[model samples]
Structures are given as C-alpha cells and as structure tokens.
Target: DTAVSQTPKYLVTQMGNDKSIKCEQNLGHDTMYWYKQDSKKFLKIMFSYNNKELIINETVPNRFSPKSPDKAHLNLHINSLELGDSAVYFCASSQDGKDYNIQYFGAGTRLSVL
Candidate 1:
C-alpha cells in the first residue's frame, strides 16, 4: 500500500484550461495538505485540512481549490490555468506534529501549461 499517491505524474495542457489532481494517503493521519513547488524547488503549503475541516488556507489564488471528500483523500482543482500555474503540485500528510512527525509527500503531479 502506498503512503501517499497522485495520478497523472505529468500533464501538459493549454493555458486557460482546467484540470484536477487526485491524492490519497493511507497513513491514518488526520491532517492532509497540498503544496506547490516552483522551478526553484521552493515548497510552500497551499491548503491543509484536519479531520475534514480546513485548518489552513495559504495565499493561494481563488482559481486553485482543494477538496477533501474524507480524511484520506484530498484533491486539487485548478481553473483557468495559466503558465504561471505550471509547477509540481505535491500532496502531503502529517500527524499534526503531535509526535514530532514529518510531512510525507507524494510523487507529485507536474502540470505544464502550453
């Protein structure tokens, strides 16, 4: 079983289009998060949910939305995609630092705007 998984490892699409990335974790953690990594490899948290409730919403654009159907799954949807939005999106989960935990990351979804 995978600790965290994301589909469509690479995606190439035209600008102004919409796309979605799916993620799931099996670590039985209550907190899940989404992060964006730019070409510079700077990882920043976008959104975080704990126990199905949103606990953190970073300065992410409105076009980017995160949905968690359950504590084990968090999906990201981006509308009107722009070239600037093309980056590697990662899904992560942690134990909320309760046990000095570190965030576990997925393989990441690479979105490329054409």
Candidate 2:
C-alpha cells in the first residue's frame, strides 16, 4: 500500500484559475505538512497540522489554503493561481514534535501555470 499519495502528479493550467491538490498518508502519523519546493530546489514549509489541528502556517499567500480533514489527510487548495505558484508541492509527515526525524514525502505534485 502507498504510504503517501497525491493526486494529479502533474497539473497544468492558466493563471487566475483555481486548483487543488489532495494528500493522504497511511502511516497513522499524528502530524502532516505541506511544503513547496521552488525550481531552485529550495524547500519551504507552507503549513502543518497535528491531529487535525493547525500548528504551523508559514508565510504562504492567502490564495493558498490547506485543509486537514483528519490526522491522515491534508489537502491544499489554491485560488487565483499565479505563475509563481507553479512549483512542486510535497506532502510530508513525521511524528509530532520529533525534530531530528525525517519527514516522509510523496512523489510530489507539480503545478504549472501558463
């Protein structure tokens, strides 16, 4: 079974349109996170939730939102998508408050805005 899976491994669309990416983990972890990796391969944390409660909301734009229905699922919704929003979105997870641990990542959903 897949540990983590995200829909539309690749997404292509135009600017100002709205889109969403869904993520799920089967590892039964208590925490999940969304991260964006730019073309330069720099990763930045966007949002994180532990046990369905929001714990971290980074400097991401208002156009982007994250929803966690449960401890195992976290979805990202983007509105008025912009060219800058075109990047690799990765869903990751780790044991809550366990720093020094590696976060399991999905293959990634690449969003391309034209």
- All candidates: CA RMSD (Å): 1.0, 1.2
Model 1 deviation from native, Cα RMSD in Å: 1.0
What lDDT score goes with residue 3 in model 2? 94
- List, residue by residue over 19-72, the lDDT tens digit for candidate 2: 999999998889899999999999999999999999999988999989998999
lDDT of 1 at 85: 96
Every candidate's lDDT? 0.94, 0.93
Which tens-of-lDDT digit does each residue in 1-114 have in candidate 1? 889999879999999999999999999999999999999999999999998899999998999989999999999999999999989999999987587758999999999999
State TM-scores per candidate: 0.96, 0.95
CA lDDT, candidate 2, residue 70: 90
Q: On a 0 to 100 scale, what is the lDDT of residue 89 in model 2?
A: 98
